[model samples]
Each structure stands twice: as C-alpha cells, then as structure tokens.
Target chain A: MPDTGTNDMTEILQTPLHDLHVELGAKMTPFAGYDMPLQYEGIMAEHNHTRQSAGLFDVSHMGQAHYTGDEAALEKLITADLAALKPGEQKYTLLLNDEGGIRDDLMVSRPFGEDGLYIVVNAATKAADFAHMASNTAGVGELRIIEDRALIALQGPAAADVFGALLPAAAEMVFMQCGVFDLEGVELYVSRSGYTGEDGYEISIPAANAEAVARKILGDDRAKPIGLGARDSLRLEAGLCLYGHDMDENRTPVEATLMWAIAKPRRERLDFPGAARVMQMFADKPARKRIGFTMSGAPAREGAEIVKDGKTIGVVTSGGFGPTIGGPVGMAYVDLEYAVADTEFEILLRGKARPAKVTKMPFVEHRFYRG
Target chain B: MSVKFTKDHEWVKVDGDEATVGITAYAADQLGDVVFVELPDVGKSFEPGDEMAVVESVKAASEVYAPVSGEVVAVNDVLEGEPQKVNESADGDGWFVKLKLSDKSQLDGLMDEAAYKAHIS
Candidate 1:
C-alpha cells in the first residue's frame, strides 16, 4: 500500500497492458500517474512464487527515453560514464539536482549502432526528469521520451529459462548485456537486468505487442503474473532503494550509501552537479547513512523512529514483512555511529521501543549473475 | 440474534448483551492475506468507532474500529498463531473479539445483512 492514494481518483492514466491486467483479475491501484496492478494473487503468495520460480511484472509505467547527439554532452549532465561504456551495456546512475540531491536514479544504456543513449527513469519524476534533460542536453544531445513502448520484467531464477523458451537466443545473453532481438518478427529490446536481486530480464516491447508477449511469458509453467506489492518486497529483500522513500531531493547519493554507483573517473574529475559538496561529504563522511535493520514485533514500518539511549537518531524509510526472511526487515537512515552492522538500537513501534539490530543489506542474499 | 455490518466493513452479531465482532468477507478479501493480528486484550473497553485492533496483511496494516461501545469480554485466541483463519472465515470463526455491549441503542446505526451486501457493492 505504498502511496495508495486516498484523494479523489480522477483522470488516472492506464498502460498498454491495463486491459490484460484487469482480465487477469489484478487488484488495480493508482501508482505514480497510472492505474497499475497492486496484486494478481495475494501479495504473500505472489512474493514467494517470484522468489522460488519466476515473476512477470508490468513495469511500463517507468519512463523510457532516448537522447541523441554527442555522448559527452548528456554525460556531463548525469552521473554515468556514457563515453567509456561499451555498446549494449547499461549502468545505474543518479540524476542529481544542482544541490547534489538525487532527482531520480536511472539506468543509462548505450544501444548498439547509435550515438544516442537510451535511459530508463523512475515513473514519478519522469516529467521533471525529461524537462531537466531537454534543457541541459539541448546543444549537445536532444531527449526524446518514448511512450509507445511497454516495459516488462521477467525476474527470478527461472526467468532466463522461461524467456529462452520463447526466444532461444535470449538465454545465451549474459548479465547486464542488452540487444534488439526479433522474436517471431516482433522486436524485443531486452536487457539481462532487474530490480529483484535475482537473475532476470527487463524487456522493452512495443505497446501493441505488450499484451501478447506478456501473456506468452506468463504461459510458462514457471512464470506467474506478479504485482507492485511483491515488487517492493522483493526489492527491499534485495536491498534496493525506493525513490522518495529511501533517498530523495534532500539527501545526496553519498549519504544514501550509493557511492558505488559513481564511476572512478567521475569521482576523480568531481565536476558533476554539487560535485564539490559531494566531494566534501566524502571527506567529512555522511552524518547519517542508510542501513538495513531487523526488528521484532509488528514491523517497524515506514516512518517509525529509531532510538539510541532514549534519543531519536533516525527513521525507518522502507520496511515490511520479508516473506523470505520470515521476519520483519527494513532500511533506515541512521546516525553514522549506529550504521555499523551488528549495532543494536531501539525501534519505536506503536509507542513502544522494540529491539532492533543493524545488519548488512540484501536481507536475502542477491543471486544476480556474477559472470 | 442477528448479524449487522458497519460501513467500515466490521460485522457484529448481537445476542442479548453480548456481541461477536469481526470484519466482513468483503473486507478480508480486499485485505488479501492476513499475516498478523493485534487484537485488544480481553476486558478492554472501547467506545463506538474507536480503533481497538490492528490487522496486518502482507501488504499493509489496518485498524479495526469498534462498531459500538462495548467491553471486550473474550477474544479469539486462535488468531495469534493462525492469522490465515481470517482469510478463511472472515465472519465466522475469525471473530476478533466478543463484546459486552454498553450501549444497545448503537445497534440502530448498523446495517442489516441485505443492506450491508448492498452497501459493499
């Protein structure tokens, strides 16, 4: 029920696969600007099924756009190294504000045979992100938002096998590699990557063929339709952050513990947005850092306060019952002193302080392909 | 004794001064699966419309409000270990608590089975 809005439900947008989702009996809710599926089966069953087998998710709500022209031009406005990146490779990076706060975390991909780059950004900030890119990359590169395509993710251990069963060539692809493949004459822009820390693929298909491909994918014995409810839980268990909840316009990537996404060259040059302030944060160290923690009792939940020695030190950003962990797991921004793994703190839940311990993330170990 | 439902989806079955309380099947299905329930202890008193219990599904947490002013005389002990019973039998064995009504007149405000069925649709 993350941002399951209670306001007037008016003029909500629908994706290309909206009809299929409704036909499959999905519980639809307002997400971002679209009427998206929250669940097909129950959240628990769908969550466990994806972890054990394969889950098919309709991620078309996320914004996909292409920027054309000089690679160095758009690269200057964002964090990832487009010039250094090999064709068919996609890297996760942040779209930063002038103050260095993350506007959105996006995957910048350089498709083969093109000087322009394809980038996937978060759904909520797509408008703002497009505007930012259009203005900043005007002379160097031009941004073109892609709305005619639908994005679907086939995730879990069995995803590759299931996807390969449809397009045998897809099974041959390695991790993080992407390419355009003709599946029965319908073009599939596919990448071997996903949000669930599992072996999977995110396929960009034409809006007209989305329903047919999605149905075909779900036809596999291992693949089942999953919803946004399970998507959040799987990402949490994988230690991935949700925009607006985990980190936002107020916090820098350094403070969000996402310094790893910054390339070595970018760090060396230190010329990106708020580069000086971000570099200063590196030297001084962040006052608070995002940390994973486990707490007993009815989940610490989002907005629960973290306490140490009876003083508020932090707040839980994203949290819920981890079906895999069989316990409540959550992520929080905690004081630097308490960010260390195994450190004990108190999570204030329902007016009572419950015992909690900071731990290394991916509460469930990430099973992404190392190769 | 007759079953009555509140607009918030709570159902109450009244018998003399005692009443059985639980959520309707419509509410249970809407909530998906019940993983954990935090019902008030026996003997706890609540005014009409007061939140007296917490119900957690895998996706979210919700509050169960008191349909009518009453003192909880007994609670379903089975829900603690097997919360799925609510998903299985939302208005039957899954009753959250048995209440001793303090204001019997509050019953006038509740909807009958037909009206509840109509109200939900």
Candidate 2:
C-alpha cells in the first residue's frame, strides 16, 4: 500500500502506452506525471542485461520539438549560441529562467540542414519548455512541437551491433551526432547520445510506429525490454541527473556540477538569460555543488538527509542500488568541504546514520562511441 | 519440522536443532535480479529478526533476517559471485545459511508452507 497520507494516486498520471506496460508484466508506479514501469524482469537483471547486452527502453514520454527557421537565423532564438552549431554536431545545454534557475537541461542537435533543429527536453518539464519555446517562436519563424513522435533508447555495450545492423547509417554517427534513417520500415531521427554510460542510440520515430519498432528491436536476442527502474540506476551509474531531482529552476548549471554544458563564449559574453547571476556564481564559486557518494548501509533513498558530525548539511536527490557498482550510490549537495572525493559523511537512513563517502561522478565509466 | 518467515521476507526451515535459512521466493521475485549477497560471517550468532546478510538488487537493497535464534554454521559461498541463482532456485540451491539452532522450541512458532503463503497473500 502507498503511504496513505503522502501520495494521491488519483492525481497520478498515466503514459500513452500504460496498458502495454501492464501487458508486459511491468510493475508500475507514478513517475513524472506518467504511470511508468519500475521494473519488468527486475531492475538488477535489466540493468546488468543492458550493460552486458542490450536493454530496450520506452522513453516516448520525453518531449520532442523542432525549430524550423532559416539556419542562419536560428542562432538568435536559442539561449545557446546556435550559430556555432555545425550540422550533425550536438551539445548538452540548459534553458535558464530569468532569475538564473535552470528551466531544463536538454540535448540540442542540428539535423540534416542548418534550417531545421531538434531538441529533447526532460519529461517532467516539457510543458514549461513548450510554453517557453512557443512564446519565443512567435517572433521567429515557427516552432513545432513533435507530439506525434516517440523515442526509444537502446543502450548497452552491444547497442552498436544491435542498432548498427538495423540502421547502417545511424551506426556510423559518432557520439553527439544525428542521422535520419529507417529501421524495420519505420523512419527515425537516431542520435548517438544517451544517459547510460554506454555506447547507445536514442531513436525518435512516429508514434504510430513506436510499439512496432520497439518490438522489432526487442526481438533481437541481445535486447531485453527495460523499465524505468533500471533506467534510473543506469543513469545514476553514469552520473546523469534526473531533472527535478538533481536540478531544477532553483539550481544553476555550475551548482549542479554541469558547468561543462555552458560554452566559453557564452560564459564570457554573459548573453543568455540569468547570465549575470551564473557568471557571478562561476566567479565566486557556488557554495553548494552536486556530488556523488556511496552509502554503506541500506540504500539511502530520495529525501534522506545528509549529515556530518551530527548536523544536517544536505539531502539526497537520487539514491538506490546501483547494479553496476554493486552497492548503493547516490547524488547530493553538501558543504563544499564535504564534496571532495573520498570525504566521508553519513546518510540518515530511516533515522539511523550510515557511513558514506563522496566519490567521483559516473560510478561506472562512460563508453560513448567516439569512433 | 516448521517454517517461519520474517517481515523482511526471509524464511527459516527448522528441524529440531538445525535451521536452514533462505529468502522466500516471493521476496526474490519482488527484488528482481539479485546481483550480490553479503553473507554473515560463519559462526556468527544472531537472534530472530536480526539483519544477518545484505541482498542487493539493481534498484534497492534488502536485509535477510535470521528466522530463529542460532549460530550460523555455514553460508552459501556460491552466492558471492552467482547471486542470480537465488532468482532461479531460491528454495533449494539458493539457501543462504545453515544455522545450528540455539533453541529447538522456536520451531513451534513458525508456519508451514501453506500458512506462510496465506500470510504473504
């Protein structure tokens, strides 16, 4: 039973393919407005399966939007300096609130031509992204929200071989590049980027072909349908943030340990929204920074408080069993002193403090296909 | 002979002075894939309901409790590397610990397979 006083099930939302998850014996739970599968065969199995083989993920709930303005004029609309975005190159960036808070972090890729651009935003913040983009596009040419498309990410070491055979062109695109291709008769915008620290591809196709194409990929002996449970763990192992959890409007990229997403030109020019505050933050050094840690006891779940020497310092954003690391791993914000790698702290798990230590991000090494 | 279960979902198969401990199949299924098992040191003694071992899955961690008061005589070393065997054969080959019972009277407090099933359902 759910915590009666805490969660309201009626307010929970369901995804477009909620029934399909049920049919596949997925254990469902509320996640970011959608009733998503926590696991199917199990989180550990699915996690390990994806690491050693291939795992099929249903990520259709993510927002897909396209911007069609003359490529030469696109640089003026986005917060990032899109003018420098060479065709086929992708960059991780964030849309900022006027006050310097992160509206959402996203992947922006210029597809075939300079005239058309595609962006993938977090599922929970898609509404705000659409609203922001819609308002901004009124002055530009046209901003089209591709609501009819679905995204499926096949992630793992074997992802290349599995996806390579299906779309030869896609297999050739190096990490952070995009290619338009077809798999099993369904056309898609396949990108060589993923949250898991593995060589993988995120394929965007028409919603009509979502299930059919997913089934076809899962038909491969190396691929097994994964669920949101392993998805969280996989990304955790890869040190990727889960938006609302690790970052939000109240957090800046620098504070979130995502300074790399900000370009040098933008940082120096201070042209983006909240640039003054972000620039100051970089100059002064943010007080609290996101850091990774490993818990010694029972998994320190979300909302667990972090303490050092009996005083509360921070709170865990995402914490749970990391199959790849073979222990409980999590991300949290702490006093800069405790954020150093190997700095010991304690996680208050169910009221009992357990020993924990700060560690480097990506508990598992990333394996992007730079080749 | 009697069987008892802890709320943590471990079971103790008691036969007089000997007790065999393992996680219930239901618990194993709910846990999904078992990646690693931290076995209690052999000869370690614990009472009923004490967390004796750690079971890790991809998403969470669970405690395997002692079903009855006893000293662990042996542990399933095979699980150190092949923890998935618990998901495959949780009842037999996946048995976690063999304890030399400290009190045989504890067996009377346990439930049979049918009763344990009803309790879980």
Candidate 3:
C-alpha cells in the first residue's frame, strides 16, 4: 500500500538489501509480497550456523507504526490498556475486527518519556493492519505508520558479541529495552528482542542505511545472512507463533497460548475492543488450547488434522522438524482434554495417521539474554 | 567399491558383502535445513528398496529409501543430535546406515554415480 515496489513491473517486492542478498548467492523466494532470500549457504547450514553462533536476518518487511495523542484519547482506541504499562516496558497486543477476531498480533513499547507509543506488526498483515487501525480508532490517537524504516534482526548465541563489536550503543540495551542511537551517522532504534530462541537484537534503521549496516554486520566471519527458511525454523524451535499460520482472526489469545500477554487491568475493565468475547473466553476457559506435539512417522504441516480416538478434534498450526529438539515438532489446537502434556494423538499426514503426543513447549529451550 | 543411487535420491556405497547408505547432496539441498533424522532400528531387514529412515527439514519431511536389498546392521547415531551433518556433507560423512548385503546382486539395479548425476540433472 505504501509503494514498496521495485522499478520492475513484476509486482514482486524486494527488500532494501536485495542486491546484497544476490551477491551472497542467496536463494530467494517471494514472501509477504517481497522477494526474500529463502536460504544462503543452504537452509540446513544456515540453521546450524545460527544455533552454533550468530546469524543475520533481513526483516525489513515488518511494519513500524506510532500512536500520538493524550492518554485519555489514546486509550480510547488501542485494545491494550497502555496507560497501565510503565515507561520502557513492551507489551504484546493485537488489533481486532468488529466481530472480535484478531487483525494482527503486535508488540507495543512505551518509549522512555512516553511522548508517544511505538509498535511493530507482521509484514504480511501490515497493510491490512494499518487500514484496520485507521478505520477502527474512535478519533482518539493519530496513527502514523513508519514506511521508511527497515527492520533487521541479528540472532543466535553470538548476537550480543556481534553487536558489541559493531554498534556499542546496542550492546548496552537490555532485553526488551529499546533506545535511539547513531550508528556511523545513521540513526537506528535498537532493541534486544528476537523470535529466535537465541540471545539476539532487532535494529530498526532508515531504509537508506539498511544495506550499509547489513554489510557491516555480515563482514564478521561469525555472522551470516540467514534467510526465511532458517528464520521459521529458529522461531519454531523457540515455540514462537507465526501470525497467519499459528494465529489468525478466528483464533483468540487464550486459545493460542498467549494469555500471558493480556493484562489484568484490561481484563478487569473489559474496556477495549473485543473485550466481551475475549473476557467470556477467559471466564469459561476455551474449549480448546494450543498444544505442542511430536510427530512419529513424518512431520505434520499447517492445516494437518489432529485426531483423538479416530475423531478429528483440531488442526496443526505450525509444524516442522526442530533442529535443537532433533525431531519433528509442531503446535496445534486440540480438544482441552488432549492438550495436557504427554497426551497421545494422531496427526493425519498424507491420509495416514501418524502417532504423536502433546509435549510441552518450546520444543527447545530458549536462551534470551536478560542482561 | 562403487556407489549407486535410488529414485528417491538415497545412495549406497557397496563393497562386496557390505554397504554404506546415505542421501545424495542434491536431496539434502532440496530438503533445506536438516534439523532431525529418524533412522531405522539396527538389525532391521529389508529388500532392495525400503524406507529405512525419515529426514525432517525446517521445510518438510522425506523418507530415505534403501537402494539395495540388505539388513540394517548399524545406524549413524550422530544424526540424533547433529542432523546438519547430512546437509554439510551428504556423501562423505553424513552416511545414515550400514547394511549387510543379503543379495549382492541387488546392487546392479541402482544407478552409478554418473548415472545418478545425469538423472538429477
């Protein structure tokens, strides 16, 4: 919607570092309207490199937006009860349609001093998210979408060290804490948060500076530009959900195992959009809960059916082989009765029921650095 | 000793009565990142072509078929925790299983390395 297209008329969008990716011999694929790298040095190799050291991700496709207004007016719009959040804290929230379905899942951060609130949403849903947010707000806060920023994440065990060497200001920022800084004359909003199960940093900088910054980080032998393939696997290993796959408008926060993101103040007041249905779900305890499973014969992918006693009960949301866990792992919505740990179920794969069991998430242990 | 390949892209390096089995480099590349591999139990017996292992990538899962009829005598336990080895060196170090040839004549059915390459090409 913001004219993020290339000069070519193919309608296939390209990231700011498209040339860089090509130079690195990356295999590119169309994702979220952008022609993104699927892998470089191969997906398996990149995945192992990230788990063992550090890997760079070009996530410029994610959307960046801001909310500006007085407290009362701002509170009237956003579903999250933001007034309750302390400065420097970030909360995961969602935009909702009138029917109480989620529009997109996002992270809202209360920047220091709180002149305004900053948030990021999924790239695939960003266009719709902006339109939905603009149309649904009750003339409260003026939503400003940042279309010129490029979002990139450097993830894995050696992320901190990589950032410490390249950008000292980013090294000092604690996990979930973000601040503005100048990197070689380029101003960037740096935060220590990532979907990968590794200690990492997410940097938001002007689109013009993306290629140079990416080059600087990738100059290190320990850092490689990972593609969407490894990104999905890393997040899967971390037990993080992919918005359109693991969650959508039809899914509720509670049913998605993201109830922790809902705040107590909002729950008590039930003041935001979709409060009635979400609150009722909170009270009644949804009939189904998202649970992790380990497939036996083969991997169960998204939309695969989950069966119990030969009856279809749920569907697989995100399924893939977990590198860290050394097996095929996935998350699915199953009957509350079969959501507990160690509950045996069958995943329908290629018309065959593969033996599987509900296991505790994440499939692998997370290594986020709080310091 | 010579190597032969199956239609599913698995390869077997046969030496007299013994054979070493693994997937081809092309197959590994197609699978994307090799996160996990479930190998058949040791001592399992199978014919010329059988599903002896399952390889899972971040993208999908595929079966590793036996190129020659044999009895599985050993499996690569290292794959249990380091499946990436398969992608890193699918032919050299990523061998998945070792088999005791039940019928050495079965090796004639699989394609040679050059033939396998041509098939993939």
- Measured with C-alpha atoms, the lDDT of residue A193 in candidate 1 is 90
Writing each residue's lDDT as its tens digit, candidate 3 over A1-371 gives 23766675558788788899999999888898898999988765788799899999999888998777655554543467777776766667776654456667788886645668788899999898777666656476678999888889999888888988988766777777777778878988777888888888888889898999998998888899999988987888788989988878888877887766666786678776677888788789889888888865357889999888879988999988666676678889998888899989888876778899988888878888787
Per-candidate alpha-carbon RMSD to the true structure: 2.4, 4.2, 5.5
Misplaced by over 4 Å in model 1 are A1-10
Full candidate order by TM-score, most accurate first: 1, 2, 3
Candidate 3 residue pairs in backbone clash: A44-B33, B47-B69, B48-B69
**Whole-model Cα lDDT of every candidate shown, in order:** 0.89, 0.82, 0.81
The DockQ figures for the candidates are 0.63, 0.36, 0.38
Give the TM-score (vs. native) of candidate 2: 0.82
Of the true interface contacts, each candidate retains a share of 0.57, 0.57, 0.70
Per-residue lDDT tens digits of candidate 2, residues A1-371?
A: 33578555467665556677788899997777777888887777888999999888888788988888653343333356677888888888888887678888888888756657898998888898878777765665576888888788999988888878777787788999886776667779888989888999898978788777777787789998889988998999899998988998899887898878777777777777788898898889888889999975367877889999989888899998787787789999887777899999899864578899999988999989998
lDDT of 3: 0.81
**Candidate 1 residue-wise lDDT, B72-112, digit = tens:** 99999899888889999998989899999999999999999
Model 1 score (lDDT): 0.89
For residue B101, model 3's alpha carbon misses the true position, in angstroms, by: 16
Better DockQ candidate (2, 3)? 3
Cα error, residue B109 of model 1, in Å, equals 2.9
DockQ rank, highest first? 1, 3, 2
**TM-score-better candidate, 1 vs 2:** 1
lDDT of 1 at B78: 94
